[model samples]
Target: MKRVLVGIKRVVDYNVRVRVKPDGSGIALDGVKMSINPFDEIALEEALRIKERGAADEVVVASVGNADCQQQLRTALAMGADRALLVDTASAGGAPGGDLGLEPLTLARVLLALVQREQPFMVILGKQAIDDDNSQTGPMLAALWDRPQATFASKIELAGEKAIVTREVDQGLETLEVGLPAVFTTDLRLNEPRYVKLPDIMKAKRKPLDTLSLSSLGVSSRARVKAVRFEPPPQRQKGIRVKDAAELAAALKQKGLV
Candidate 1:
C-alpha cells in the first residue's frame, strides 16, 4: 500500500496580533489562540484527496512537540489521516536546547527518523509556519533524506510512481515531475482544507495516536541556531490626504520622494 506522510504544526492563529515578550525571550502566548498552521492544513488536505481518489492507500500525520501538539494531530485524524505520531522533544533528557520549540534542522532530523520507520512514498508539509515563517523544514528534510522535493506546490497530480507538481514562482507558475519518495511543501493556492464534521471528530478520538520520545530517534535535538529576541516591525507613519495632484506633487517634492 502506498503511504504518504503529512507534517502538522501548532502555531498562533494567523488572525491574531502577535507581540514580543517584554523579557526579550519569545513571542507571548499566555492566552493567544492557536491552530494548525494554515499551510500544513493545505498539505494534509492534498494528501487526503490523493487517498480518497485511490492514488494512495494511507495517509499518516506527524508532529514534533510537547503533549500540547496532540490537539493538532487529532484534528488531522479528524480530517482523514489514518493515524498520528507525536515525537515528544520536550521530555528529552540532556537535550541541547533550552526552548520547548524545535528548530527546523532538528525538526528535519526528527522527520528523517519517522520517514525511515514509516517508509512513506512521499512527505508533505506546509511551506512555512505562520509563527516563524522560516520556510526551511521541507527542503532540509529532503536534503537529509536525499530525496527530491517540490516547494511552494500550488497543484499536485500523482501518476504511477511520479508526481507532477505545479509551483508558484515569483515570475509565474512552473511545473515539475518528481519521483516517489519525495517531499512537497504546500502553498496558499492549494485546495482549501475540509472542515471536520462532528461525527468524524468523535471517531478521531478513538484513532491510534502513538507518542515517542526524541531520545528513541537517536537524533540530537541540539539547536544549530538560536533566536536572540523577538521584535515587532516598525510602525508605518500615518498618511495625509492632499487637496489635489498639484498639492500631492508639492508634498512629494518636499519629502524628496519625487
Candidate 2:
C-alpha cells in the first residue's frame, strides 16, 4: 500500500468525570483536562505497525478541531505518522458541539473530499471515541467511499494490492478479503503502540502539516441536531439501610406478596 490515512481526534482526558446537562445540549466538562482520543491512537498504532511490517509506504494522521488540536495532532506524529492534516470548522458559524459532541457525519464529509484527492491505499479509524462513544464515522466514510470495511480488526495483511483482514466477531473469529482502498477500524488488541524516541520526536517538528477548511472542501459545518438548553441532573437518592441479610429478606418480603 502507498498512502494510509488515520483519523485522529482530541477529547477530554480519560480521567475527567463527564456529566450531561438535563437538556441534553452540552457536557459539564471543566476544560481542566484534555488529550488525544484513544481510538485514534489504536488506529495510529496499527497503521505504524503495518509500516513496520513492510506493508505500507506512509501513514498520515488527520484531525478536525480547533487550534488546540495541533498539540494533540503532534502526538500522532510523535507516534510515527509521516505527516498530518488539521481541519478547522468553527468559522462557518455552526454550533461546534453540545453534550453529544461534534457530529461525526460532518467530519466524514470533509474526509470524503480528502480521500478523493489523496486516493490512499487505505484509511484507518478508531472504533469509537471515549467520550461520545459514537462509532459512526469510520463506517460512514466507508459507505461514502463505496469501499469494503472491517472493524474490530486485531490483525491485518496487505498483499499484492489486496488486504486480508482478521477481525474478532461474537463467535470465535471472522476473516475477510478486501481489495486495496479499504477502511479499517482498530481495537486495542490490534497491537501495542510504541512511544516516540527522542530523534523521531525532534524530526516530527520539521514534518509538514497543511491546514484545511470546510469551505475549501465545499462542505458545510452545520449540525442537524440542535441543542438549545443545558442543566444538571437531579441528585440520586441514597439507598435505604438494612440491619442484616435476614432484615433485607424481611424487607423484600414485606414490600411484596412473598
Candidate 3:
C-alpha cells in the first residue's frame, strides 16, 4: 500500500504565552495548553491532500514523546490521518518524557526506525518544532535513512515514482524532483490545516493508536547534548523619545551609539 508518514509534535499552543520557570530549569508547562506543532499540522494536511487526490492510499501520523502526546496524535487522526503511532519515551531510563531533554538526532533515529518498519512512500515533518526550533530532524533522518529530502517545501506534487517539490530558499523558490520514498519538511506557505469537525473528533477516538517504546524501536532516548539552563530574554529598556535631531544626537552620544 502507498503510505505517507507524517510526524506531529506536541508543543505549547502557538497562541499560548510561553514562560520560563523560576529556577531556569525549563519552560513552565503547568496547565499550559498543548497542541500539534503548526508546521507538522501543515505536513499532515498535505499528506491528507495527497490521499484525497489519489496519489497516496493512507496517511499515518506519528509522534515521539510521553503518553500525554496521545492527545496531539488523536488530534492528528481527527485532522484525517488513517492511524497514529506514538513512540513512548516515558520509560527511557525512568526520566520524564516530553520534558525538553530529547535531542533531534535521537528523534531522527526514532523516525528512521518507523520508516523502516512502515516502508512508506514518503515521510513528512515540520521544518522545525516550535519548542526547540532546532530544524534538524528531517535532514538528519534523511541522511540516516539514505533517502532524498526536500526541506522547507512550500508545495509538492506527486508524479508516479517521483515527487516534485517547490522549496523556499534565500534567493527565492527552487523546484526539485525527487524519486519516491523521500522526506519532506513543510514550510509556512504550505496549505493551511483544516479545522477538525465535531464528527471527525468523535470518529478519531475510534481510530487505531498504537504505542511503541524507544527500546522496541532499537533507538535509545539518551540525550547527547544537555541543556545547561533556560533563561528568558532580558527585559527591554524603556525607549527615550527624542523631540529633535539634536536630542537624538545627544541620546545617541549618551548611549555610546554614535
Candidate 4:
C-alpha cells in the first residue's frame, strides 16, 4: 500500500501572545494555548486529500515531542490520519539533557528514522512551525533521505509514481515534477482542512497511537544549536498626526527620514 507521512508539530497557537522568559531562557509556556502548527495542519489536510483521491492508501502523522503532544496527534487522527506516532524524547532525560525540545537538525534525524521504518512513498510537512519559524526541517529531511524536495508547495498532483508540485516563490509560482519518496512543505494556499466532528473525535480516541523512545530509534537527539536567549522585537515608536503635507515633511526632515 502506498503511504504518505505527514509531520505535525505542537506549538503555541497563533492567536496567543508570546512572551519571552524574564531570564531570557525561552518563551513562557505555562497554561498557554497550544495547537498543531497551522502549516502542518495544512500539510495533513493535503495528505488526506491525496488519500481520498485514491492516489495513496494510508496517511500516517508523526510528531516528536513530550507526551503532551499526543493531544495534537489525536486531533490529526480526527482529521483523517490513519495512525499516529509520537517520538517521545522526554523519557530519555528531557531537553536539558539533550533528549527533548529538539532543534531542527535533531528533529530531521528523528523524522529520518521514522521514514526508514515506515517506508512511505512521500513525506509532507509545513513550511515552518510558528514557534521557532526555522523553516529548515523539510529541506534537511530531504537531504538526509536523499530525496528531491518541493518547498512552499501550494498545489500537488500525483501522476503515477511522480508528483507535480506548484510552489509559491517570491516571483510567483514555480512548478516541478519529482519522483515518489520525496518531501514537500506546504504553504498557506493549500486546501482548507476539514473541521473535526464530534463523532470523529471519539473515533480518533480508539485509533492506534504508538509511542516510541528516541533511543529506540538509534537516532541522536543531541541539539547541534543552542538558544542563548530570546528577546522580543523592539516596539515601534509612536507616530504623530500631521496637520498638513508641510508638517509631515517637516517631521520627516526632523527625523532625517526624508
Clashes of each: 0, 3, 0, 0
Runs in model 4 deviating more than 4 A are 96-100, 243-258
Q: Can you write out model 4's per-residue Cα lDDT over 1-258, one digit (the tens) per residue?
A: 899999999999999998888877778889999999999999999999999999899999999988999999999999999999999978767774221268888889899999999999989999999877889999999999999999999999989889999999999999999998899999999889889999999999999999999989997766557667678899999988999999999999999998
Ranking by lDDT: 3, 4, 1, 2
Residue pairs in clash, model 4: none
Model 4 CA lDDT for position 24: 71
The C-alpha local distance difference test score for the whole of candidate 1 amounts to 0.91
TM-score of each: 0.93, 0.84, 0.92, 0.93
The residue pairs that clash in candidate 1, if any, are: none
- Using TM-score as the measure, name the better of candidate 2 and candidate 3: 3
Assess candidate 2 and give its lDDT.
0.82
| C-alpha lDDT values of all predictions | 0.91, 0.82, 0.92, 0.91
For 23-135, candidate 3 gives per-residue lDDT tens digits of 88878999999999999999999999999999889999999888999999999999899999999987885443334657888999999999999999999999999888899
What's the lDDT for residue 233 in model 1? 79
Give candidate 3 regions above 4 Å deviation: 94-99, 241-258
lDDT of 3 at 66: 84
- RMSD to the native, candidate 3? 2.6
* lDDT score, candidate 2, position 154: 83
